[model samples]
Target: MVIAWEDGHRSSYSGESLRWACPCAECRGEAGSPGRLARVQSLEADELRVQNVALVGQYALQIAFESGHSTGLYTFGLLRSMCDCPECRARKSAT
Candidate 1:
């Protein structure tokens, strides 16, 4: 997915990366439980690709991956926080 920030910056992310980064309760699991990445050990790389995307009240996104995972509600802030752009990466490293 791609996002154009209000500050005139553009950000893009690969579907596979986003799938692995799902922030849903199921994906994250209980405080110390195994996560989605751990549970999905047999998945092929193609299974992580996005199949569809839907907006959630203008605040978030609901993405369906090729493997049929689609419960995560990716908030805009969370999406921005996950940006892998050089600027975002540099800012995080600086902190």
Candidate 2:
């Protein structure tokens, strides 16, 4: 999906990348536990497919995948940071 920011910047993301970056407690973990994505070696196609996306009260996005994992609330900041555009990549590398 592609998001156009209010500042006229555009960020794009693929389904697989978004799925891999899911920030739910189950996917990102809490406390000292490892997340499911970290333990899993690979993801199936269905797991990476974006089935639906919905806004969460102007703060985040609730994305559902075909694999039935839909717990991640991708906030605007999180999504923006996840952008892989050349500029963003360069900025991250510099930091």
Who wins the TM-score comparison?
A: 2
lDDT of 2 by residue, 1-95 (tens): 89999999999889999999999999988998999988998999999999999999999999999999999999999999898999999999999
Write model 1 residue lDDT over 1-95, tens digit each, in one string: 78897889888989877887788878888789977667875567666788999999989999988888899898889889999889899999999
Local accuracy by lDDT, each model? 0.85, 0.94
User: CA shift at 81, candidate 2, in angstroms?
Assistant: 0.7
Residue runs of model 2 more than 4 Å from their true location after superposition: none
**TM-score of every candidate relative to the true structure:** 0.84, 0.94
Query: How many steric overlaps are in each model, in order?
Result: 0, 0
